[model samples]
Structure formats: structure tokens, C-alpha cells
Target: ASTPSCGDGQCTLDEDAAACADDCPERAGCTGAEWYARFDPITQEIADTREAIAVAWYATGGSFDAARTGRAGDDPARTSDNVWTAPSEPGVVTLWIVLRDDRGGVSWRTLAIEVG
Candidate 1:
């Protein structure tokens, strides 16, 4: 059988903002925020530090937060921007970025990043 595709102006259970970026794009002109990090020379991947795993929300009047939803237990450092940093340990980590506006409206974006 074939899987259903997104479009038609409806966000079904099968299609999410993350999966269907173009259809559910935000006013910021981006479906989601940007994840920034410096490259790791040793592992050839992103390093685990405050400087890495920082994200920038392109919208105004909102704040962002990050949390590690996987096995590791390291608190991520977050500002209104740079919401979370990847853990120093190596493995697959699920990261959540939550953005909220002054009027109590909220939006969420998640990424399963490899902290190798």
C-alpha cells in the first residue's frame, strides 16, 4: 500500500509540520528554526558543548527552550535563543525546541540529532 501525502490544507495525524515543511511553514518564512553548531574534527560531527546545538528562532517576541528527551541526563543551557546544547556523550539524542509568544501561543519543533 502507499502512504498518504501532505497538502490540501489539512494537517492530518500522518503529516506534521516537520514532515511537511512547505505546507505548514510559519510566518517567519521557515518551517522551523535553525540549529547551529561548529563541526567536530575528531568525530567528524558536532561537538557536545554550549556552543553547539544552539538554535535560533527567526521570529520576534518569543522565547525558546531545549531539553534532552533521550537516555542522557545533561541539562541544556538555553537563552531566549540558543535554547539547548547537545550532550557531551556520544549517541542518538532527541532534542525539543519550544517557542512561545507573549500572548501565550506556542509552537514546537523537534530533531533527533546524533551527538557523535
Candidate 2:
């Protein structure tokens, strides 16, 4: 039940909250690509808007549309509890919470949930 990793140069961490942000250079406005592994959205849909929810979107194991920002409610760290619904595609559609450590290495826990 782990999420995928986005690695460095492709993602960032939310200092205030316990979430990660994906690097999407093409995205406009405050919206950016992002993903999470541990946080589940389905279980959080009825919770308060302030709760953190895991989310991501991809196509064929590749980057699709980056996650939109401003969805994390009052959280100022740019983190969100939103669920990313990707377009229907072929191959493995991987989603994950890319984490970065002090060593500068990246790690991804597999969240291989197939997408159309």
C-alpha cells in the first residue's frame, strides 16, 4: 500500500504538512503536480476539509497532468488531501509519495493501482 517515488528534480516536500509536491514545469498558477502514498482519499472524503488526503495521476507509468494546488485547504505548506483522477491509459499507471531524505537519495513505495 505504498506510493511511487518522483525522485529529485521532479518533486518537493511540504515543510508544514506531511505531504509531497511534484515538479510540473508546465503547470500554470499555484497548481502543481503531487502524489501521496499513506494518505487515502476514499476514507477521507467525509472528513473535515483540513485533513490530508493522498493523491496522484499518471499515464502509462509516465507523467500525465500535474496535481493542482490550492486544494489542501488552510494548509500553508502547499500540501493537499485531494485525489488525482488521471485519464484512461495503457500500461502501468503508478502513483506514489516521492520522499527525499537528508542523504539526498530518493525512495518510492510501490502503489501500483492500475488505471484506464
Candidate 3:
């Protein structure tokens, strides 16, 4: 059987496993039930390394938002590059991220998600 890595945001691999034993030594295990992504080497070469991104979660009544502005590294483990979880409710959520130039113009990548 083959397990595919998801760059398409539909499915993802367990990314928080390595930190579990160390961070929660008394706990049995750590589970990462979230999406994961790595910066494409080809994309990184073309874009500014210090690019910024914004993350937002949409729920029934309102939205939750966060941002990683103008900082860069290729590590997917970093929270700044991507999100860990979507909303707990079974509704729509959106992640809006951007790789920007020094002039701070808008360049966006929108991830539409459904959470349950």
C-alpha cells in the first residue's frame, strides 16, 4: 500500500510525533490531527525568503485570525508557515497566506477547508 503526502490540503501526515515523548514525558503519546505542508524547493527559489502569511479560521458566528509576517524558513514544523488545526465545528474555514516582496504588495494563497 502507498501512503501519499498531501500538498492538496485534503489529507496530511502526522507531523507532531517527534516532539511528544520529550514535551510530555509522562503522557502515553502525542497525536497530530492536522494538515502539513513543506515549501516547494522550486517555489522558494522564486519567492522572497522573508515572505509573510495570514491564517484565519471561520466558525458559526465569527472568525479567528493570525498572521506570520515577513519571516522565512523552510521548516513545516514551524507554526508560522501553516496551521495546525481548523475549527472544531463542522463548518467552513479559510487560510489566507501570502509570499510578499519588500514592497509589501499582496500575493495570496487561499486554502479552503471543512472541519468537523
Candidate 4:
């Protein structure tokens, strides 16, 4: 398959506002929300440290302000935030949020957003 490029007029799975703002215009609005990562509290307390967590955002339509967001190992924050702009048309859009930790742990969540 060919690499997805901006100005193609087709927003592929890999394209978003950050990657192709022109092709995928930001239309929908989303409040800034926080997403949490799972971790062992005991280990975190013992080491006084936490694994770095990163989140990758994807959607079937619309666009995201950022491709990823996360907290570093040294940072105490347990959540990451991202803003999603919905597609211009009204429909059900599939969205995915994937989270990965510095220790190779990974998880993901799928959301069905109803745009009107």
C-alpha cells in the first residue's frame, strides 16, 4: 500500500489534523479530557516512580489536535489529554485510543461517537 499523503483529499486511517489539516478539516468539538493508564500502585510507591505512558489517537473521520499525549516517568501526572474535532458530516465515527507504557505494556479502547 502507498503511504498516505496530505492534499490527497482522502483521509486515510493514518491521517488526522496534525498530519493533514487541509484534507481533514477540524469540524467537531470535544472538551479536553483525561485518560488514565493502569499501573501497580505498590510498585509505584516502592520505587517512587512510574512508567512513562503515551496515548495514540485515531478516528475514522474528523481530526485530532495531536497524534499523541502522555506523561513522562518522572512526571507525577497520571493522565493524558487530547482534543478531538468531529467530522463535518453527521454520522457514527469510530475512534480509537491506544495507550503504551515504557515497559512494553499496551492497551486500547474503541469509542463510537455520534456526530450530529
Candidate 5:
């Protein structure tokens, strides 16, 4: 067996923190009191969700836009609410959240989610 490596551009369900940092980067501001996403059961089953999307956000970053891969549907909406949605599939979905500051400096974050 081989160890997982970050920045390989390939994010799999088996990948871990040391395996692929690019796909599983950490977000200090998007958890617990500052959660960014919520799964909607009404959308689809937990294992096979490639249609609907789960909402995501950036707790206190003003506001932002989003985009995703590995599914089918309209791209997640970009609004002040920062209501981005994850792909419905149950494994290894990539989500990119873009944040623009008032001065126009742009930055983003990515997550490799194993849905289920």
C-alpha cells in the first residue's frame, strides 16, 4: 500500500490529511460555531446524491461565491448569504469557495468531501 500525498490533483475517498492536502485543506473559520454547510435530506439519499446539493458557507467572511465538480445541475449560487451547495454524491466531491474582500483581494478554499 502507498501513503497518500497532498497536491496530487487527485482526491479519493481513501485520501487523508497527509495524502492530499490540496483536496482536504482545513478551514479554521468553517466549523462548530461557524459551520459552513448543511445537508438536506429532502434532496436525496446520503449515499447516491449527484443531483441535489448541500448548502455551504463561510461563517464570517463578509460574503462569497462558489463552484463544484463531479455532479450535474446548475452551479451553486453566488450571493451575500454565501449559500453554496456541495455535490450530492456520497464520496470525494470537490468544493471551491471564493471570497472577495472590500479592497478586491480574492482568495478561496477547497474541500474534498466524502459524502454519506
Candidate 6:
């Protein structure tokens, strides 16, 4: 089987932020979630609904307290948090966040952390 290559504008399952930084460019300071207004058929009104998001965290180096974290549709939080333990060695570490919504929406973001 042929291996996936970077710079193809696609981050395949075999590629990652660390291995393919160009394909998975860094999006600094992004929350990876958003709220939108939707029409409620039952209420016959437009309601502001926050998307229920789940974040799949990946990193080249370091350990995360949780692999995923997010709020449900009913939850009001606009953001989620996870704990990451940096590696003992000081160097640049690549991290990726795969955000998924209940409405079949998906996106990803990357971060380059300097561990020193």
C-alpha cells in the first residue's frame, strides 16, 4: 500500500499534525466550537443553540488526562478543557484537536507548543 504524503491538502488517517504540519496547519487560539441560531419546529421560533462538540486530542509528545472532552447540546459552555502533561525533554511538540459536532460537522486544529 502506498503511504500518504503531506501537502496534499488532506490530512489522512495515516498523517498527523506532527508528521504533516503543512496539511494540518496550526490554528492558534481557536476554541474549535461555535453557536448558531436554529429554527425550532415545535416552538415555531428561532432559538440560539450551541453546538455539542467533542474534541479528539492528539499529540506527538506528552500525555493527556482525557482523550476527549466536550459539552452536550443542553450544556451552555462554549468551550472545553483538557489537561496535558509535557514531556520531560524540552522541544517543540505538535498537538492536534479534531472537533466533531452532532450534526455531522467536523473540523480540526493544530498547535505547536514549545516545551522548555
The lDDT leader among the candidates is: 6
TM-scores, all candidates, are: 0.32, 0.26, 0.33, 0.58, 0.30, 0.59
Model 5 agreement with the true structure over 74-103: per-residue lDDT tens digits = 333333344444455544456555554322
* CA error at residue 103 for candidate 4, angstroms: 0.4
**Whole-structure CA lDDT of model 1:** 0.46
Candidate 5 achieves a global lDDT of: 0.44
* Cα lDDT of model 3 by residue, 1-116, tens digit: 23443343332222122433333224332121123344658666443343333333333423444444333334333344333455556766665555443334444555555565
Better of 4 and 6 by lDDT: 6
lDDT of 1 by residue, 10-53 (tens): 54444567877666665453333233465779889985342222
Which pairs of residues collide in candidate 3? Answer: none
Backbone clashes for every candidate come to 0, 7, 0, 1, 7, 0
* lDDT of candidates 1 onward, in order: 0.46, 0.41, 0.40, 0.76, 0.44, 0.83
Please write out the lDDT profile of model 6 over residues 11-87, one tens digit for every residue. Answer: 76567789899897775644545678899999999998877888899999999999998889888677888999999
- Residue 106 CA error for candidate 1 (Å)? 0.6
Question: Regarding lDDT, does 2 or 4 come out ahead?
Answer: 4
> Between the candidate structures 2 and 5, which one is better when assessed by lDDT?
5
Supply candidate 2's per-residue lDDT for 17.
18
Q: Candidates ranked by lDDT, best first? A: 6, 4, 1, 5, 2, 3
Steric clash pairs (candidate 2): 3-96, 4-96, 31-69, 33-67, 53-81, 88-116, 89-116
| Model 6, TM vs. native | 0.59
- Give the residue spans of candidate 5 off by over 4 A: 1-88
Question: Whole-model lDDT, candidate 4?
Answer: 0.76
Candidate 2 local lDDT, 23-79, one digit each (tens):
424435323323323444777544433423234433345553455322343454654
